[model samples]
Target: MNIGVIGYSGDKNLEPVKSLKNICFEIGKLIAENGDTLLTGGRDGIMDFVCESAYKNNANVVGILPWDEEGNKYLNTTIKTGLDFSMRSFVLLKSVDIVISVGGQVGTALEILGAYAYKKPIILMRGTGGWTDTVTKTLIEDKYLDNRKMVELYQAYNIEELSQHINNLRGDVNL
Candidate 1:
């Protein structure tokens, strides 16, 4: 199985950085131990940290980059396969069996939409940043994900809880 990690960008803060790094390591370790591959956008911030951790853990890590040229090298080094991010969203969605959305921005929102369309399992890590706080509102207030035949939404605030919730959703095709 492949677990994709989605997060925000251009965000720089000591606590957020520390949290992202820790979550990256934990997610990498979990994926390695569980014999699952790790996937991400492979950019700076959370994507970079997680990709680095996955590489360190010797797990198969794929980076779906948003660029086609020599770009975002800081995080691209750890990626096993680097695909054009915008053009390869379909491949990324198909590559991952489950998606763990840590934090988000516009790109992350689009990732969520792609995952939803593909009928994949998604775990939302709340309080991280970006659209995390707006997920419940988006689904309930806007009915974005309501009454869907497939697609599971699990909200968590930390890496441990997020991991557990993902494990719990291993059996359910959708939430």
Candidate 2:
């Protein structure tokens, strides 16, 4: 299955929150070990960190780029949407079976909303800060978003829990 990771691309320095970056790395490693493909925005922050770990672990990495720009050396496959950020985000969310949100800003929130609109399952890594934390606290109630029974929002406090949740979703107990 392809899992899309959406989060902060960081500032001009391209520096991600240290602790959140570590969590994203572990999540990527787990995804690879479980024989899953990794998808991302193909920029910096959580996207770069997770893609790097997934690549090292020999997972297929697909980057949904907003433009035809180069410099995404980590991605095994690149899909240049040739669209603006918002439209590109829709493609990213639509291409994946599941979506995972790390710490992020407006972009991440848009991705999450896109996932919901697509009716794709989403797992929010709590305590990672940014909009992810806010979503965990506000937007969802009783694990459902906006009383939308068709889509359920899941929260994982750590990598282990996140792994278990993914495994459960796949009906694999061995992971």
Candidate 1 deviant stretches above 4 angstroms: 11-19, 70-84, 141-144, 172-175
Best by lDDT: 2
List residue ranges in candidate 2 displaced over 4 A. Answer: 11-16, 171-175
- Score residue 99 of candidate 1 by CA lDDT: 85
How well does candidate 2 match the true structure, expressed as C-alpha RMSD?
A: 2.9
Instruction: Give the per-residue lDDT of model 2 (tens digit) for 1-175.
Output: 8888988886424545655667877988998998999999887777888998999999999999887755256799988888888889999887888888987889888888889888888898888888888886666564766766567778899888898778777752122
CA displacement after TM-score superposition, residue 156 of candidate 1 (Å): 1.7
What are the per-model C-alpha RMSD values against the true structure?
3.9, 2.9
Residue 85 error for model 2, in Å?
A: 1.1
Clashing pairs in 1: 65-85, 152-175
User: Residue 126: error of model 1 in Å?
Assistant: 1.3
